[model samples]
Target: MDKKLKRKVLTASLVGSSIEWFDFFLYGTVAGLVLDELYFPSSDPIVALMLAYLSFSLTFFIRPLGGIIFSHIGDRIGRKKTLVITLSLMGGGTVLIGLLPTYAQIGVAAPILLIILRLIQGLGLGGEWGGSLLLAVEYAPKGKKGLFGSIPQMGVPIGLVLGTFTLTMMSLLPHEAFMTWGWRIPFILSALLVVFGLWIRAGINETRNLKKRKNPGRLPNYRLLIH
Candidate 1:
């Protein structure tokens, strides 16, 4: 690949990976601190926090299923399209979470919706990491594939730092305002990052590996089990 195209591929991989992780981690950061109070309220604070963390934990269980499903699609279709689908699922769920009514407004439905969105986030992320890594590595120059592959992995820490910093700053608002709307800012603003990532990924060509394969076969179910 040409230098310019390679640069675009790596940038898309890193940016998309970072945005997905940022959205995923944002929920965890808020689960104990904010979601417990607003969406999983209970008479006992401990129960409420546990419920919130439960919602957070639900994602991990669902992620493997997501990985299998999307990985099959990635093998059958192409990485670019799968990346777009995963990002949309992840980012759309996040933006909607920001807009959801609290338990105070919707009662049990609030937590239920939160859990569903968390599942969607899990699925998106499960597919995202593999696709992003492939995008970077497949397009990398021959001798530098390892270096390019590592670029997408960097998104994890980058996303964690950004999520923590943004939430910390938002936490500075008065308790009332922060609970009321401040917490939503980062989630809502994530839409912009998603849009930007989509644009970048859209401009890149399909990976040479996928292009070379004229007839990509189905990903066997046993392979999923092995992985």
Candidate 2:
């Protein structure tokens, strides 16, 4: 692979992974800070917070299932295509969450729908981390593989910083406004990040390693191992 192309692929992987994770972590932050007040409101504050945490934790459980499903898609279709699908799914979930009605408006349905969206977000992310790493490492030339592989790893901290920073800025709004509408801004704004990620990833060519494989029929076994 050409040096320039390797750099492009690495950048795309890093940026896309970072954005997906930012969307993912944003939910965790909001669950403790905002979800209790809105989606899972209860007379007892402790119960509301516990419910919010439970919803957040559910995403972690669903993530592996998402990995299995999307890994299958990656094996059958291609990594680039799978990454696009995951990225879009994650972004769509985040945006929808921002638009969701509070418990006060919809009663029990609010928490139920929030859990569904969290599952969608988890599913997207489960597929994203592996795909991003592959996108980076598979494009590396010779001895540079380890360095390229680590680039995607940087996404975790970068995503944490982005999520924390965005929420911090949004928190500057008055408490009522922050609780009422401000928190949704980050989730809705994820759509723009998704647009950028998809555009970058669209330019990435399929990895030559996959193209060189003579037996595409082995993909189902790969998916099973993921399970």
Candidate 3:
């Protein structure tokens, strides 16, 4: 790949990875503070907090499954397509959580839906990390593969910082307002980031490796285990 195109791919990979992690970590930041009260309320504040954190933790288990499933799809279909789907899933779940009605508004169904969205977000993230890293590394020019691979890793800290900074800013609102709606702003705003990431990723062609594969055959879980 040309230097210009490699740069574009690297940028796209980094941006998309950052956005995904930002959305993923946003929930963790909000869970103890806002989700407990709004989505997982209980008479005992501790109980509510635990429930919220439980939702946060449960997603971790689903992530590995997501990684396996999406990796297979990436191998068979294409990394670009897989990355787009994962981003959509993560962004879609985040936006929905922002728009979701609270337990006060929807009763038991609210927390259930919130958990479902969290799982979706987890799944997207599970797939997102590898694909983003691969997208950067695969497009990298000789002698710079390590450097290009490191670029996507930057997204982890970048996303964490961005998520924390956004919430800190939003929290400055009056407590009632912050609790009522301010918390959702970051989640909703993720849509714009997703759109921008998607636009950037859409411009890049499929990596040469996938294109060169004449027959990308299926590799089931059992086969993977055997290997």
Candidate 3 per-residue lDDT over residues 39-132, each given as its tens digit: 8777899999999999999778998988888888987888899999999999999999999999899899999899889899889998898788
Query: For residues 113-143, what per-residue lDDT tens digits would candidate 1 score against the true structure?
Result: 9898999999999889877877787787767
Candidate 2 has a TM-score of: 0.93
Q: What is the alpha-carbon lDDT of model 3 when measured against the actual structure?
A: 0.88
Model 1, runs deviating above 4 Å: 220-227
Clashing pairs counted in every model: 0, 0, 0
The local distance difference test score of each candidate is 0.88, 0.86, 0.88
TM-score of each: 0.94, 0.93, 0.94
Name the lDDT value of residue 100 in candidate 1.
95
Instruction: Please identify model 2 stretches exceeding 4 Å from their true place.
Output: 218-227
Checking candidate 3 for backbone clashes, the offending pairs are none
